[model samples]
Target: MTDAPWSHDLPWPDDLPPFDPFDPAIQADPYRHYAWLRAHAPVVRAGRADARLYLVSRYDDVLAGLKDATAFVSTPPGGAIIPGLLLMLDPPLHGPMRQTISRAFSPRAVNAIEDAVRTLVATHWDRFLASGGGDAAAGFATPLTMGVIATVLGITIDDAARMRDWTNSAVDFIATRIRGVVNPDASVDSYAAMRAFMADAMDRAAADRAAGRGRDTVIDALAALRDEDALTADEADGFACLLFMAGHETTTLLSVNCLDQLARDPAALWWLRAGGSPAAFVDEMLRHRPSVHRVTRYAARATTIAGCAVPAGAPVRFLIASANRDAARFPDPDRFDPDRRGAPHAGFGFGMHICMGSWLARLELRLMLAHIAATTATIAANGRRVPVEGGAFATSGLTRLDLSVTRRSA
Candidate 1:
């Protein structure tokens, strides 16, 4: 990939040293770290307490790296960080697995389920509104997203809460090189619980597929794969795991973030409803308060970024929040101005491997925001909700969202 104009602004450190990821000071306000890294260290060595890795904070470098699959592979071939899961595999092999999953996951297919998703959202909305409202995150977003995932996967709505537990266990934690200096065992237990649950779910689905009792599910379609495009057992499991994780988790976050932003800013909300252009608010929400805050890339080969040469076998962290808020690419990057006349930001991502679900995510957020605005009389900050720690990955968002509302007078 060609180097971008913005790459010129990124400067590498001459005296490189690994910054500690586990530092409480860094965790408290990572933006300070992001500023230091993006301006002075495009590629900086960083220690995550016990874990060692390199941090890549700038937008341009991270974009280049994600596009350069040859130099920054997603996963090794036939790789299963856990057995029977192919979502973790790299390209040549990952291509086929992705194709198989795409049959079910792509925007076209997901679009077909829009009515279902909207209905699910309304079902939760009615209940949440009737309950005099509670934790918006737990009461509404969780069930709404959880039902979408379950329904799409050909599961019963009764399994809504079960799927919620599985999704939370699998994703609601940290994932960066850095973390709080707390229980080593808790992390292990959380991961173990998630994997075990998913494994059981996969096993049950697999058996149902063989017995011809799986009903018509994406899992059944995947299980019944024939010709040259079929997945191995582990690949199926891995794909299922990744699908559930991605489908519900990020969708939930983006919806909450969009609604929260709209409630706080009436002009932005008005912009969304007028001219049939909620996409602007959606773009701003993604740029301003992107759900997935950080992502990782391991070096596939030696490469130079922003004039710094990196050896093969190094890991790089991409601070996405910083990238969206980058002044080089976005004017007044920090301010939440949806009407700012500029190019759409890389809130979803740029280059190859860009989020396939970007459109759907935008649609979901728009609909949910529209629903909340139309249904609720008023939305304001009352109490507060803590953000979940992103664990080893700094993408965790909104463990709680305290929202107060009154019915919109019809």
Candidate 2:
């Protein structure tokens, strides 16, 4: 991780337990450390000196930070904000851009794609069941999610694979940039390639519209809006890229996590199989094992979070995963109880910057889990599950999860 130009000047409580965000052990399973942080140090400094982080683990504190955009802004002062990237913008710019983009990507738009998503999930599940299951992440979740997002973007199957690769690199680039780290493995070429692809897609959509052939895709919608001067060319392209990158990977991880959790708890699987609510089950899964663990925000002004003083321009890491599991907010937070209800989880985030594609993600997850429960009589771990490397900062889920399943006898 590259050292931040800003120094770690926060008062570090001496009795707080040592915590490192990059530590492989903590990354693998951070619940224990999160618990400690919430109990002893709801807000504290962690990470290396150069890339120091003001970590917030308590649910209330994190929620408040996410809500108060004035105090905790998306981008730091004087920081280079990516044009058209909705997540990186704030206030005056963010609201209008978000409103404009919402026209293209909304709940209604997502609902329109439900049948296609269902078909994709059914097809993938069929193939997996026929083969008695394999690596659920690769054989099922990954391709299934890629197909759904590709459909949403109106991209060809041939382009989906390449887009996935580009999305990975782009995500790595973003994560490293947030951490002040220089990722040697990630490439700027990927960003160029993705942007080029989006531009081409928008152009194609525009051409098709000119020819009186509307595809009714998100790209098509954005293209029309662009023609109306509602969005700039850069904004259109950036929205497409963001949707492609954010849509697939996070959903894929959530699907795999659901499956993993099901394999461990037969009762949960049975409950799902017995016509229990997939939406509720998926909701619990999100809280129990969210795909993305943390999000970094810059302190827009000097403030006190959870009673800890934070300097302006400081990088504050809101541990979403930790917040979801906060005992003070959710009784028996550690337990994975689908029926459990209380405060909403921070799995999809909260406040102004909550995930825009959250509804689509939930739809995909619910349908996939419902299909699995309906079709599969048994689910069991077949081998070791491999975690995504260096996913602690960006996203975290199994890269490979071997599972064996038995189809229900019809």
Query: What RMSD does each model have against the real structure?
Result: 6.0, 3.9
Model 2 residue pairs with clashes:
none
Task: Report lDDT per candidate.
Answer: 0.62, 0.84
TM-score of each: 0.79, 0.93
Span of ten consecutive residues with least summed lDDT in model 2: 1-10
TM-score of 1: 0.79
Residues 1-410, candidate 2, lDDT per residue (tens digit)? 22222213423356533567776655767787788778767787776766568888899888988898888888766655666789988898999999998888655667779989999999999999999999999899989988888889899877989988777678777656644556799777888799889889889899999999977689999998889999998888888898888888888889999999988988998998777899999899889899899888998887887666888888898999999999888999889999988899999988888999898899898999889888989999999898866755556778899999999999
- For each candidate, how many residue pairs have backbone atoms clashing (under 3 Å)? 15, 0
Distance (Å) between predicted and true CA of 2, model 1?
22
